[model samples]
Target: MQIQDLPYPDPGVPDAHSGPRFLWWLGRNQLGGQLKSLAWGLLHFTSVTGLPFCVGFAIQAVVDRSGARLALSGGLLALCGMLIALGDTFLHRAAVTNWITAAARVQQLLARKTAQLGSALTRRVAAGEIVAVSTGDVEKIGWFVEAVSRFTAAALSVVFVCVALVVYQPALGIVVAVGVPILALAVLPLLPRATRRADFQREKAGRATELASDTVAGLRVLRGIGGEELFLDRYRAASQEVRHAAVRSARMWALISGIQVLLPGLLLITVVWYGVGLARDDRITIGELVTVYSAVMLLSYPLRHFEEIAMAYSFSRPSAKRAARVLSLERATDTAGSLDASVPSGDMHDPATGLLVPAGRLTAVVCGDPDAAGRLAERLGGHAAEEASSDTSVRLGGVPLDELPLDSARTAVLVQDKDPVLLSGTLRELLDVPGSGDITPEEALAAAQCGDVLEALIQGSLDAADPMDARITERGRSLSGGQRQRLALARSLITDPEVLVLDEPTSAVDSHTEARIADGIRSLREGRTTVVFTSSPLLLDLADRVVLVHEGEVAAVGAHRELVHGEPRYRAVVTRETDEEAAASLGEVLDGGVVEGGLRDGVRDGGAAKHDPPKKDSHQSHGSKHGKPTLSDVLNELEEIEETA
Candidate 1:
């Protein structure tokens, strides 16, 4: 059956009630296997119980007549023992199979849910929590499932043995039967405490997993900032919390275990005491007394499952809740009717920023904050908005983005991040994304400036015809930072999305390589609407138009050179250099002397302008006559100039 077709109850708010429902749901799904296991467990337990009865009969026969009859009874007892041994081995095998299969089915359900939720999975649950649920939680749930049949067999054995005793000796039989249930149910009071502690421990463990995953993901950045020690300390603290939680959980379990052992022992003593009294009174046979004791002893085994099932349920219920939370994440809306998978052909517009990205044009978005750029990119790509801003609207060809089907929207707009994931595979396989064969690998590689990557791939024995056959290590860990970024860019380019949104695509590469890639991308994506969010001068210079964003609003829109010369704030923000020439020009204007440098030099001289023409050695020698000015000095001068103008 298809994964989608698998039956799963909407595990509503996992709590005490949900645990039973989950088990019922699992049983319903695997009814055949469960029934088989139950039958085998009953058969095996019955055979084991029969051995004690056979021994009692043999002893009684020997007492009554020490001839052929006693020998016949002894042989019968030996045969029963062998049968009991054989049944037990098969029963154990069947029960274990049931446990493994049940756990596997639950794991499949979780895996399917993860696939359905996709990227939305992380928004609702931690990565570590998912890991814990799939691994540890599934096993615990299986333990409870397997225990069900074992417990059933144990309860039946107790009843069967009690009936035999009653027929043989009523007074002793009643005590054993009545006291077995009391011993089994003795742990009920401790269950609530155990469950609570287990829940707490699982929660803390999930947090520790999340912290570790986050730390590992950002290890490079942490080391770069010399904050690895700080993060490590935080992880240690979280680990300690998890340890304490585990100890708390263990304490409750230990108490329950003590009761499980102590209560059963007490019940056994009570049974023996009553049986011995009947024997001394000459009311019951010695063989009958031994039979009664063996039955009680056998009943203890199943009684343990009762306590264990309670503990397993307590632990698994919270894990199921976590898994359910992840499964509940809503997928992005698919607006294009399922049949309309056609590529979109039009300009992209964001009314929130009053920005128009014209079709067949290269657009550069220069936001003062990197986060703002990233958010905008996410919105344009049809991903969920990171913030709650009703005023913001992204549209394609005048169609509201939200109205478009998710698949179509995604196909039309692609957002390539600075660090895109590279699945383990040969470099050729990595480049071959969806719609790969439509465009030649050579074209995509050239567009992404991947000539060197291609050489490395060939050197590593990657064949063009069987690119997917190449093995990529986990997350492409074998690749350098820049190679990984370029490979991701290449994958996106291969898709040939109608509107491509790139965030700092060239941020990791050197200037020379960045410049080459910038030119190649402009040429390769000539007729597509491409919005590149970057502070790199080479990429900025290649854009047809640059939109400057400040204070969460569009401050200006113009060609890169025009924006550099006309907008002092844009230059300061992008280049991160002081506009000293602009300040000096302001002083000259105030002194009524012609500024020696032109407007380009005035604004570009001291500041780094992303689109400013390359500076010659001679230009560097030129200095402002006024004292060295900072970007703030330029801003102040611009304010004065604006007032005078």
Candidate 2:
């Protein structure tokens, strides 16, 4: 592929066994690009090495005092210069292309891994470290990949120059050729110390970067706690350590550079000393002597590629290792599960919690503890905890959800957490996710009560754009909390999954909108199984059945009205009514009024002074059939301790 066709269609599964292995894999995959760079690099360096020969030929022509030879030699010199310029230009372009493509491929791989792992990736790895790997480490790896090909070309050119010189003037060419390799390899001893110092410096700098990031992220907290100056002091100390380490690292590289210059200068002196003796004895001419000296000077430039390659390897090794570690990560949910247990079409059961949600019904679960609700929702969707494999809790159609492949399980169950994120995109793109296509976009939007959201999106645009085409910023930060919630709900509704789990789907909206949303959810998903974890009375009253989860397990299951009168814990969770408040209230509900103690001061029971039950089914949502007053009369507002569940 060409350089422009970057971000490979498939980044391919990596070796990921070790840092070196990962780096090698990257190199092998990009061999085509590397070879392109190598070809251009050969042209550039070979032309450069041939320049000394052109200079030697021109000098001989001038010494001969022949105009024809002088003109011909000058022409050759200019042609060689032209070739050097053309080669250098293309070589650099090709090398930089290699660098960019390598980085893009690595980024794509990391992104795919993150998508596969979902939220589990963040739990297993530090977010800052992940960012550092994608940013700085990726660049380091690309640098090494691009550097390798150039180093190879430079080495090859040096070999050519060595052979040419030895054949041209064996007496003096041998010394210069042998000395060139010595100068190139002379820095090998210093490289270990230099690499160690560089690693130390990088470590210190990374600490400094992380410290600054943490301090800034928590700056508001630090200021509130009156510890801003303390953090500033700590940051200053980290900065100083980084500076010291950088200076130490720079000093080691400077020593290597000094040796490079000094040794080559000594070799030059030796060649000149011997060349002068030969010329005085008329054994070799001035032009040959100049060629030998100039060739050494030209070879010195490419020789630096050796040190550069070594340094590049030292730095990129650790970066490759970090990338491999992230790529190799596997969540417990990512297992080779049974293909036969693919799509769920029956009742969903959680044996561990004793909760069975009948298919084709809306089941509302009232769990007082937010953590328990979250865990249950994830389990219902066939997701495992970040640290370990999930237990045999949830099953679909009598088959364990975990026993099904992740893709099949995810396709079967869609779980929208309390805080559903709205990614940056047009409404059309956002809703264009995997779905059965049974629900239209307009139907989903209406069911989600997003008319006002659609209006805001259109109005917020600079032009009179279509509502579906209007863009939402990242995470919908530009929209209100309720607007984001409704938008996310609409997208989920559009998917129309086999089974859906929504945790506090309407927490951010007002009471009237929440009621409408409840009705919308009921109508929109008439035949699909949906489990809503919420404390809202409006939604609970509309569920086909209400399941009360207490202490992380199902405590009671019944119609909304039955649970309200029969279970005190259920009343406490949904009505926000405390046990003390219940103790101070009138006795057991009696046909609308308190039976023994009579009605509490203002309590009116849907004016029901007679017993009534659902005409066809007593266990059905009493709120839907018995009217709101029977349940609303005793209902109280739940404590708003958590903004979301």
Candidate 3:
């Protein structure tokens, strides 16, 4: 595909064994682009090298007083100039295309990997490291990729110039050949130092970026706990460290640049001085001497490419390595499978937990531990199972999920984590996802209770557009927790996967709203198989079967009401605490014997007589049996009596 057709249909599998190998693999994929770039680059540099020869010949023709030869040299010079202009124009186009396409391909690969790994990707790699790789590191890798063609052309042109000079005049040729090699090699020792400094600067910058990311992600939490200043100070220090490292890295590059310039200039001076001596000694003609000097001057131009190529390699090597590292991370469930087989529609069973979710039924999983619940949901979706000690695996339709094609497994079961992120875009764009197309966006939104959310997006929008066209800020920061949850749920519902697993899908919403969302899920997904990992009674009550998972084992499996009554462990996890117990604990915390006379009767008697009998003690209180008076109520009654007196 052409560069314009970017975000390639497939980025192709990457060789992620090492950074250098990854880079080489990328080069091989874009061989055509690289070849075009090299051809244009060669044409450009060759004309530039030939320009000096034409000038020297013109000088000789002028010295001979031959108008014909002078005109010939002048015409040849103009032709070389025209070729240089033509070649340079297309050279940039080809080279930049290579750079952009390479970057786009890598971005696509990273995006695919991220989607494949899901929430587990961040756990394996720092969010900061990923940000660095996708953003800054991608460009660095592309920079090296594009630089290779230009460097190759420049080196070839320099070699051609040195050979022609030696054939024409050996005395000057030998000096130039020796000096050019020295000029290229002069900064080799210093390159290692510059690369180290650059790496340090990149590290500091990544740290600062990560700190800023964490701060922004938890801004609301920081404000709530008044830790904003503490983190702000930490980020400030990180930024300062980055600045210092950048300055040091820049200094090293500057010193290297200076050395490159000094050596080339020294060689030019030596060539000019030596050529003049040859002219005086009558060993070479004045035009030949002029040609030697002009050629040396031209050599300086391509020689600088050496320094540029060095810098590119130093930066790109590290970037490529990081990209490779991320690509190498595979799902624990990753295994071989035949592409020809169709995915089955059988029950999903996790052997580790011995939990079976029958096909075409809504199953509720109640796990006391939130972390364990999340892991279980991911396992059902064929995600991570790294620590499993058994040879058996999670199976769907009687086949191990790991042995199925990745895309097939993903399409069959979609596990929505506890907190799904909402990317910034218009409402329409946010909900536009690849799916079975069985459910419309409007239907999904209604099922997810997102009518209020849609209205709010439209009202808060700065632009005048249709309600669905209203834009959402990054991560839906403009929306409340419940609104974000509803919107994310809507997006997930629309996907219409065969086996949908939801982890606390309505935890952020109120009980009333949660009840509505639970109904919506059950009704909309009536015929589909779904597994919801939650302890909410509102949701569990609707499930066809509820599985009580305690300490990584299925303790009980039955209807919600049956489990709540028969299994004490399930009751404790779902109810948090019984109403009577909670009320007794709260009643005991009251003062002035309210717990003894009023609260105990109110809760235990289940709405007893209005008034409690007056107690004998001076500090004893009397109030409605169902409603105990608080300290503020007593204070207000006393104030009213004093005013009346």
- Give all candidates' CA lDDT scores: 0.71, 0.80, 0.82
**Model 3 residue 557 lDDT?**
99
Per model, how many backbone clashes are there? 9, 0, 0
Error of 2 at 255 (Å): 3.1
Give lDDT tens digits, candidate 3, residues 1-645: 467698798899999999999999998999999899999999999999998889999999999998999999999999999999999999999989999999999999999999878777888888878998999999999999989889999999999999999898899999998888998899999999999988888888878887888788789899989999999999999999999998998999999999988988899899888988989999988889888888988888888889999999888888898899999998775664654357668788999899999999999999988999998888888775565422456888788777777788877888899879999888999999879999999999999999889889879987846868998999999988779989999999999998999998877765566768899999999989999998766687789999999999999999876765456677556645444543443344343343444434332222212332222211132332112222233334434544686
* Local lDDT at 127 for model 3: 89
What tens-digit string does per-residue lDDT give for candidate 2 at 1-645? Answer: 566786689999999999899999999999998999999999899999998888887788889887888788788888888988998999999899989988998999999888777666776776666777798889999999999999999999999998999999898989987898789888998888888887787777667776777788688789889999998998899999989988998898888878878888899899899999999999998889999889888887888888789889878887888889999987674554645645868999987788999999999998988888988888788766654444554788887776677677778899999879888988889988888989999998999899999999999987747999999899998888778989889889988989999988887776667778899999999999999998766787789999999986799998876776668788666655565554344343333232333233122222122222212221233342213233334323111211232
What are the C-alpha RMSDs, in order, of all predicted structures?
7.0, 7.1, 7.9
lDDT ranking, high to low:
3, 2, 1
TM per prediction? 0.80, 0.85, 0.85
- Among the numbered candidates, top lDDT falls to 3
Task: Give the per-residue lDDT digits (tens) of candidate 1, residues 1-645.
Answer: 222434444422222245566676666666666666677777777777776676777777777876676787778777877777776787787677767876777777777667544454665677767777788778877777776777777677767777877776678778876877787777888888889889999888888887888888789889889999999999999999999999999988998889888887888898889889888999888788887787777766767767777876887778666655554454454334644556566888787777789999999998878878887787777655434232455878877665565667677888887558887766656766776255666787788887776555555654554443556677877656677778788888888888889998876665567768898899888877899998655677779988888876789998776776678777765545556754455445546543334533544433323322333222132432111233444445555655787
Q: What is the lDDT of candidate 1?
A: 0.71
Pairs that collide, model 3: none
